[model samples]
Target: MTLPAIIDALQCGTFDREVLKMLRDGGYRCVTPTLGFWEGTLESLDSLARWRDMERENAELIRIVRRADDIRACIADGKLGILLGYQNTNLLEDRIRYVELFADLGVRVLQLTYNNQNELGGSCYEKEDSGLTRFGREVVEEMARCGILADCSHTGDRTALDTIEHSPGPIAITHANPASIFPHARNRSDRVIKALAERGGVIGCAAYRNITPDWACATARGFADLIARTVDIAGVDHVGVGTDFSYKGDDAFRAWMRMGRWSRQLNYGAGSASAPGAVSKPDWLPSADRLSDLVPALGEVGFSEPEIAKIMGGNWLRLYEEVFG
Candidate 1:
């Protein structure tokens, strides 16, 4: 089997009305944001300067989805629902107040830290991780109050644990894998992985091609293997697909990824051979992309039909409903 059309959900950049139409035309019901955002994007929402020019260039196809029911409804009606999220909190600045503001604007999930240390907490890319500070606690509290999911995918070890322990609402990790199987700072440990599952959260294991040791299970198969292993450790109900798809202009994207808040600052962001690099271009859309290949990949790993549904999008939908409905 090739794959299904329902996927090709969200991309890192370049969503326009024409893009949305093509996605809808392809029979896509919903498009999940494996990684919901970039720093320039959130800042651009308020200012039209650089982002404005970009938006105008890609006009008509961009949307920010913030609710689970919205996605279900859109998928049912043959439209695409964009799940609003972010890869880092640098866009939030220091004011935790922005969490609710973004929530009001339809941003549902937020990663505590991005590539480097922000005011809230230390990032995986940072040389030292001191965990969540008082300010970071306030940040998590605000996230709970606003009903936005607290994400730990890019957070440091201690910070992630602290957030998990303190978050009032169920937490969400958009993308990760087992560091034991493949050593990577972006990956999680068994203890933390199980903790997330026990805490009623979902861990989205990505394609992470760079992190995989086995060449045979590279694409969807590799993605599924990590998800399956995570499910085995955390249970089926705690897994989902967080592709970490960073689709955009290659040179520009790499520049952004390698830089800190300012340009020309090279940072060692987290990852290993098991993980995939960022997305490729601004014009790409995952909705029209073939994503269902993971279903068979799941089958190869002995995942039953029901488990497949959960890993694909069921668990994410359930959690999304719990917090964002």
Candidate 2:
């Protein structure tokens, strides 16, 4: 018998009917789409509304997933469940109450910062990492109270650690890799990984090329090897996949992601200055359709069938139930 549908814990891309179809064809039952990459209240509201409209428009093929049980039901019924998420807390606009507001809006995951300093905390790319501020602590508390999962993907090291320590519940580094594997600024250290696992949190190993050694060698098997190593370090129960896949490869999409509305000049944050607008995806796992390749790759790397199942989706499912429910 086939395994249950997989859940991609973190995905940063445009969500539409085509994307849903691709996920369905790829055997995904649930995906948490990050519609609020750098969006504030109005922008996040608009994006969330658009997705809600899409859910309504394609009710037969997809539905909004608010609870953990919805995931298995969607898979059993042959539909894709969209779990709304935000990559930054810009939508809160400094008010702690907005955490509950956005939580009610179907945002299950909320990243504290996105590549730069925000009102709440510092980012990994900053010249001096300032860590989480007083307000940031309040936001974490409110998120726990409101049943929203705290994420620290692009947050500064100090801030990420602060959030993990300050949070009343487990927090996630939703889309980052181990810095030990490939020393990128965006990757987390073993210290952080251990702290996260100790707190009952999960880390989703990212598939972005910049986080790895080189795009040419970052094939599906190579990525799976990285995951295997991560599992060895963080334990299989504390690791999952967060592909960070972007459907749009155009310069416009690149500009929006890199610069957002923060600057007019190109900011080569993750990508290179020479190819600032180009998205370098591995051929072996180019899109959501190729995610299934990880199963066999994980097996080849010595992950048992049960372990592979947990790494693929079961781990994330448990995290969602604990945090979102």
Candidate 3:
């Protein structure tokens, strides 16, 4: 049977022709290349610079997705569609207008916070979640108005629930797993998952080792089983894959992702302080080239072909249509 077009909801890394080739080989026709802003500053020139770089460097191999139709068009043309996304609203600084500005620049996804509290709301690691602040409510409204998805991947439980309650439209938790499966700060709870799904939102399961049950449960099959369980909770229509793959290997990149100038000391955010580096990924899904293995793995987990297709990519496509104009 022919597989459906695949869309990764969130991946963090640089994009180049080689990466595009791997995505194409993996049967991924569309993906969200999420870049993060950590400094909590209004200067988003760096994000713009990277967007321009991807446009210039891989113009032939990939096309930036601005509209829902662009995804299918890019896939039919054999070009990977890049859905520009941000993991934090720090780039917005204090101005709500920047939400529309970033949307004009083709940013389709925006997470309210990262691993720490921001102007919008608190993070999962915060001592106490402040929930959605007044500014956060304004940002959510503006994002919904501008067709930018409100993401809650790194947001605290209260903030995430608040987003679901206050947003005019559905919101997404783009890269997370179930806390019930693996008790981690980065994972979502059943309450959050059900609320998101009830609001017409989708949840993308992450492949990060720390979010999985253990090193043994980090395989492609294991990830598939996780998705299966998520489906049981959130329904198949609201579950998809967000690998959260960071294609960087340098120590600086690792440290930046963890601390990102937010702390002077080493903050082992996800993994252990002993390592503070990239954790070992499953052998079945080390990179985008291995993403295709998920299809059969999902089948092995007893998902019907149509259900597997939705988990593979259809659900996210529907979400983009509803949220991204």
**Model 2 vs truth, CA RMSD:** 1.6
Q: Which parts of model 2 are misplaced by more than 4 Å?
A: 215-218
Model 2 C-alpha lDDT per residue in residues 1-325, reported as the tens digit of each score: 2564677878866667788898977878888888876777898899988998998898888988988899878868988888888888889888888889888888888899987899989998998888889999999999998889999989888898999999999999888898988887899999889889999899998877777656423677888888878987899899998888777557777677778998978698777766555656877876778889878878888888888888888888888888877
Q: Which is the leading candidate under lDDT?
A: 3
Candidate 3 C-alpha lDDT tens digits along 163-225: 999999999999999898889899999999999999999999988777776642457787788
Taking the tens digit of each residue's C-alpha lDDT, what string does model 1 give over 125-223?
A: 678998998989998989888878888988888888888898787787777777887787777788777888778998876554444445323455655
Give lDDT per model, in order. Answer: 0.65, 0.84, 0.85
The TM-scores, one per candidate, come to 0.81, 0.96, 0.96
Model 1 alpha-carbon miss at residue 97, Å: 2.0
Candidate 1 TM-score to native: 0.81
After superposing candidate 1, which stretches have Cα over 4 Å from the reference? Answer: 1-11, 16-28, 32-44, 47-64, 214-219, 263-265, 268-288
Question: Can you list the residue pairs that collide in candidate 2?
Answer: none
How far in Å is the alpha carbon of 164 misplaced in model 2?
Answer: 0.8
RMSD of each: 4.7, 1.6, 1.6
